[model samples]
Target: MGDDDVLATLARERGRALFGYAYLLTGQAHAAEDLVQEALVRTFARRRVGFTPDSAEAYVRRAILSTFLDDARRRQRWSGVRHLLGRHDEPARDPAPAVGAVLDVRAALATLAPQERAAAVLRWCEDLTVPEVAARMGLAVGTVKRYLSTAGHKLEALLGPLPDDETVPLTSGRTRP
Candidate 1:
């Protein structure tokens, strides 16, 4: 069959399934519909060699996932720079908390043992994985973990508890400890 025939067949037979998949990903009926429509447009934008109904549906589903992920990444990037889009630059805000927090952290680090301080710095500041921190310090993994745990406790006591779910790494090759 031709491309238009394949597209028509897929939309007639597999449209509900595609909409349901998009709904699962987006979690909103309107958003799901939009995603499905966008995916359909993107999938059929390029000419395909031999696209049956099933294959066309598969391609559309893949396009939906790609569009969703791309949108999420774009939103994240936009959020980081969105402040610059506004014209209001308030000059009355105090900037000392940013400076004070750095001093406070430095002071807290001074109180920790040398090994504990080193582990904390490598793991949090350097954004190294547990194994990487251990390798850099010439210590065992368990040893590095222990030092980090102790250092975390010490820092928390001084700086107050960090957010329970906050565990993003700055720049690491693998998962953060």
Candidate 2:
């Protein structure tokens, strides 16, 4: 196959996984899609005259990581201003009864620092080992462990104790009796 055909085939096979990875990083589906597209575009632009498939996947993954890190930094810079605008102006709606558990998890996740959130997502959601997460996040294993521990503690505090009953409401604002 021609070089373009090979590239297209590889993208077709890996695009969904790439998007999923991006979503894990950004926590927003639309932003994740945009990140994946931007990463692919940047990777294609910097493509070498003769690159192997093995090298290409590594390159793409690196590009995705760079994009996510850069985007995080940008968001951090604007977060203070965004927070000042406040959430009170937002529209209200009925909460999803079934998704209360999911929303509780998301809220707990939001309370974590960015590195902690990333560490938790990489370790749990992505099923990456501590060493693997450290490598991917460019941190030491000790640092990753600390981040994960901090995240777990914060989640426990925010979520409170788990009830004996598995069917207990996660966000119903009621303590187990």
Candidate 3:
């Protein structure tokens, strides 16, 4: 199949999984859908040869993650100077009833820094190893480990005690920022 066909097939067959992955990272359905669409556009924006459905999916998934991380970084940067822009915070509203039990986990996740949440999701939900998560996030293994440790602690405080496997042994010695 041609690249277009491959992408179409991937979207038709694996759409839910792609959206679910994005949703896990975003914690909002609309945001997750937007992420997936952006990733698909990014993945296919340029013409390329020999893209299979599997490869297309992989590329889209990676794009989704990178886009999410990039957007998070941008939002973090904006937060620092947003008050200077004279924009007032909107009044908080109750979450929709559909949010239900997932609210606790999503609320806890919202407390984590973007990188920390990504690390936790990649490590625990995706079941990737520390090194693998590091590779996916383009961070050093030690950095990923530290992120996991911090996230684990924060998540535990909010969600109650986590499982024993949540801990990551930090390396001794100073890390250069």
Q: Each candidate: what lDDT?
A: 0.88, 0.78, 0.87
Q: Candidate 1 vs candidate 2: which has greater lDDT?
A: 1
How many pairs collide in each candidate, listed in order? 0, 0, 0
Model 1, 1-177: lDDT tens digits are 998999889889998999999999999999999999999999999999988888889899999999999999999998899888764565665889978977998999999999999998888877777899999999999999999899999999999984442365433545545
Better of 1 and 2 by TM-score: 1
Best-performing candidate as measured by lDDT: 1
Model 3: per-residue Cα lDDT over 1-177, one tens digit each:
987798889989999999999999999999999999999999999887888888899999999999999999999999999989665876665777547736777898899999999999777766678998999999999999999999999998888876554454222322223
**Winning model by TM-score:** 3
TM-scores of the models, in the given order?
0.48, 0.42, 0.49
Cα lDDT for residue 84, model 3?
92
Q: Give the deviation of candidate 3 from the true structure as CA RMSD.
A: 23.2
RMSD of each: 14.0, 22.0, 23.2
**Runs of candidate 1 exceeding 4 Å displacement:** 87-177
Candidate 1 backbone clash number: 0
> How much lDDT does candidate 3 score?
0.87
Per-residue lDDT for 73 in model 3? 100
